[model samples]
Target: MHIISGHHHISMLSKDAKLNNHFYQQVLGLRRVKKTVNQDDPSMYHLFFGDMSGNAGTELTFFEMPNIGSTVRGSNAITQIGLLVPSYESLVYWKERFERLAVKHGEITTYAGRDALHFEDQEGLRMVLQNNNGEKVPDTWQAWTGSDVDPRHLILGMGTIEITVRHLNRLANTLTELFGYVEAYHSDNEAIYQSVDGQSFGEILIKQDLGPREKPGKGSIHHLAIRAKNEEELRYWEEAVKERGFYTSGIVDRFYFKSLYFRESNGILFEIATDGPGFTTDSSIDELGKDLSLPPFLEGRRSEIEKNLLPID
Candidate 1:
């Protein structure tokens, strides 16, 4: 029952890889760390970007499909993807930037016991930025490099990716039973389940009566990842996840870490992934994503795969 840590990453489906990359890289300022294909759907690209090290909570991934099926949003679709920052005051700074940049935005306020701002990416993915008191992350500021980003004012963790769920009790029970989340707090509209570890990691809020599921459309979260300390813990999760009635994927080794996938009763895909052998596994800490690192099984196809992909760096 030791749920090793918090979120490892979250994946969303994108209709346009180039536009998606542009928004995330330029607007959000996150670094693209890996470019590959979906293991299950190799025809589509899997793009990963986050903090400098691709740390546990810093990961934001995408499955690039310009022609993906039409998406719809309703209950069960991830509502807002939140990123936690330690800087409460810099929120004003971000506000100015958002305004100056002229990206569509909305008001700021205290949503879940924290000061927060709500906005959307170009693709219309709802995003929330909140001040996490003082929790900080390790990624270097490559996005707004000269723009007064204080690590002390750094992102604490990923803010809860808001999700719409039906039969809250069933999903709630499953979360408590299978995953390790507990009822941390609740707002006037939703119950917030947070990691006992006090992070945006694993924090989820089930908004009451968000209503029935719809087809996922542009700007919807495809899945979210939970951390499994290592192979042993992941194996435990594989069994536990099965016993609870969610069928999980057989172990799949990503070059940086390993993973097992399953879905919560609520239909949101969940991945239990390892945190070790990070992006540094293939290249020096200085050279991640400079070149492709293939698993032995795919080594022979490296030149071919590299050739088919879009240029990142």
Candidate 2:
């Protein structure tokens, strides 16, 4: 059986491209790693933020669609995203930084025996900064040279994601049997799953959604991507999912990574993505995110795309 390593990236929707850029780049101190257009909707900007190099597990991306309304929070939606910092002291530093910036945040709290700081972005997208306590901490992606935050406390990568699901058993079985996730912890209404390979990036906390179904819009998670080692592994999953009667998008080339999208029984969008041909494929690492880039097929429309996109600070 083939299993994914962990999360490749998490994509969300945002209303204002400028505000989104400022929050992730300036406030969060993440590097603007890629500037491109959404593959399906070329009119909207698809922005990526991460550690200096935009490593696979570090990415938090967004689609800029100003016309979409805010998301309605309920069942069957990703509720929160977590980023990992180095230590408990780093959590303290962030609490003070959040205060100084007037960002709405909560006092440091403990969850699953790990220290966490809960906060929201300017768009009310819920996020958490947690201390690294997993079995194995993946390599820290380089910090941005111009970041305001200290390098010691910079976010390492994606930590965990929390989502609501109506069919917990089915989702849990698929995670364990098909994706190789192990049940790390469980309570009455919630359960945590971690990759069995001991990778630290793709942990998920799923809670029962006993309420109404969620409405997707801006500020909602668009899709969660899991990492495949390469094209062979990606095709393995595509075949596995298709055989199981799950509808898959069937290996779509994302330029950065090949992707296969399928929504599970709970209606949460999941993507299987390859880890190679990364953000630096077209642009050198030193020049990434400085210019608008398009896939070779879309290069003909570069002029139109440039005119449509708003400037990023």
lDDT of 1 by residue, 179-273 (tens): 77888876555787865446565687777555668688667788888788898888888889889888888788886789998878778788889
**1-313 in candidate 2: lDDT tens per residue?**
5666778899999999889999998888999999899988889999999978788889999999989997888898888998988889999999999999999999999754579999999888999998985346555456565688987788888888888888777788888878889888888888889874444477888888789988877788888998898999998899888887899988999898899999888888999899888988998888999888899889999988888888876
The reply for model 1, stretches above 4 Å from the true place, is 136-156, 186-189
Per-model lDDT: 0.72, 0.86
All candidates: TM-score: 0.89, 0.96
lDDT measured at residue 120 in model 1 versus the true structure, 0 to 100: 83
- The most accurate candidate by TM-score is 2
- Clashing pairs in model 1? 71-216, 71-217, 72-215, 72-216, 72-217, 76-164, 82-159
